[model samples]
Target chain A: MNFIAEIDVMPLKELLDPQGKAVAAGLKNLKLDAITDVRVGKHITLKLEAADKATATAQAELACQKLLTNRVIEYFTFEVKEA
Target chain B: MNFIAEIDVMPLKELLDPQGKAVAAGLKNLKLDAITDVRVGKHITLKLEAADKATATAQAELACQKLLTNRVIEYFTFEVKEA
Candidate 1:
């Protein structure tokens, strides 16, 4: 079976997100003041061949731990769906 | 009302995703061959002060068009939930 993983990798909340700050500043410049507290992160979609949803989710988790995330500075979450 | 927008900015399917490719190659290097067709994108969470969910969604959409996304090379989608 083939599955698709929709993953989000985000900077740890305790860590300062420079990119998000920059974007917030940019919003201020744009006069979009109603928008605030912007947090930026990475969204990833992975296609995997596995025996079932459980297997695919495990693979996705392993991939997140090993390659898709920087465990020290970032954390991730994901959902698996049929491709 | 306060809302949270979960937004994703993705490279157009037609465009070659160098970052995705690099990650895929890295996965191969790590011997995770089960994972394939990896696509990388940005995930943004915006806190917005709006009149309602519809207003929040509109603001999030505008933000995507103006700043969160590079329309020429990328596209975006988002959902707004109460914060």
Candidate 2:
């Protein structure tokens, strides 16, 4: 079976997101005032050939832990679906 | 009201994702062959002050258009929820 995993990796909220802060400041400069509290993260879409959804989920989680994220400063969540 | 917007920005499937290709090669080097067809993108969470969901969605869409994405090579989608 083929599955698609939509994974979100974000800096822990307690951590300062320099990118987000810079973007927020940039937007403010542009006079876009309605938006705030910006946090930037990675949206990774993985295509997995697995035996089942469980296996695909496990593979996605393993990828997240090993290659996709910096565990010390970031956390992740994902949704899996058929491709 | 405050609303949260979860935005996903990705390279159009028709476009080549060099980063994704590089990561896929690296994963293969690690002998993680079970995962394939990886696509990388951005996950942005924005907090917006709007009168209602409709307004929040509008603001988020505008931000995506103006700042968060490069429309020439990438495309985006988002979900907005009350926070």
Candidate 3:
């Protein structure tokens, strides 16, 4: 079976996101005052071969743990579906 | 009304994503060979004040066009909900 995974890796909310802060400031400068806050993260799309959805989900999780996120400052979530 | 927008900015499928290629290579090095391909993009979470859902969605779209994306190489999609 083939699967597609959409993964989102975000900074821990407890941590300060400098990039997000900068963007917020920029938006303010652009007069987008309605936009009060911004948080920036990574969106990753993966295409893979798996035996089943469960295997695909597990593989995606392992991939996130091993390569996609910094456990100390970031967390990740993902969903897998047939391609 | 307060709204939260989840925005996804993705590289155009026609373009080359060097970062994605690097990650794919790294995954292979880590022996996660079931993963066949990868594409990476930006995930942005925005908190904003608006009068209604339609207004919030319009604000998000404007923000994307004015600052968040370079239309020549990327495209964006978003969903807005009450915060």
Candidate 4:
């Protein structure tokens, strides 16, 4: 079986986001007054082949830990689709 | 005009991702031995009403800073579409 997954990582609200801040400033330069804040992150979409949905999901999670995200600051989730 | 945006944030590789690691372990429990890595983050989709694509993009970026994500660790981007 194969599955598709969408994953993401972000800074916790209590944390500071310099990248976001820089983006915010950049947005301001674009003259968007209604915009006040900016945060940044990554979104990954991929398909996995495995024996079952459960197995595929497990593999996807493992992939997230080792290759998709760093272990110190990121948190992630996904809805897996079997094909 | 209106636009839809997808946004994400993640830990840099230099940073540690306890969240991704935890997810990886959880996946191991699910019996997905083939999986090798995991990373975690947030994804948001929203529609913005504005005067132009450029203006809408600016507003979308602002929304990301103030509402969509936290600014400490997150950096984000989007592809805006007029609706």
What CAPRI-style quality would you assign to candidate 4? incorrect
lDDT of 1: 0.91
- lDDT of all predictions, in order shown? 0.91, 0.89, 0.94, 0.64
| Top of the candidates by TM-score | 3
Q: Output the TM-score of candidate 3.
A: 0.97
- The docking category that best describes candidate 1 is high
Q: Candidates 3 and 4: which is better by DockQ?
A: 3
Mind giving the per-residue lDDT tens digits that candidate 3 earns over A1-83? Answer: 99999999999999999999998998888888889999999999999899999989988999999999999999998999999
lDDT for each residue of candidate 4 in B1-83, tens digit (9 for 90 to 100): 55666665555546667786776676567666554455565565444556778877776767666655566665665677754
CAPRI grade, predicted model 2: high
Residue B32 lDDT, candidate 3, scale 0-100: 90
Q: Candidate 3 regions off by >4 Å? A: none
Interface RMSD of each: 0.9, 1.1, 0.8, 6.0
TM-scores, chain B, all models: 0.96, 0.95, 0.97, 0.77
Question: Predictions ranked by TM-score, top down?
Answer: 3, 1, 2, 4
TM values, all candidates: 0.96, 0.96, 0.97, 0.53
lDDT: the better of candidates 2 and 3: 3
- Evaluate residue A63 in candidate 1 and report its C-alpha lDDT on the 0 to 100 scale: 89
Residue pairs clashing, model 1: none
Candidate order by DockQ, decreasing, is 1, 3, 2, 4
Error of 1 at B62 (Å): 0.7
How closely does chain A match the true chain A in each prediction, as TM-score?
A: 0.95, 0.95, 0.95, 0.80
Worst 10 residues of 2 chain A by lDDT: A25-34
lDDT of 2 by residue, A1-83 (tens): 88999999999989999999987887777667778889999998888898999988988888888898999999999999998
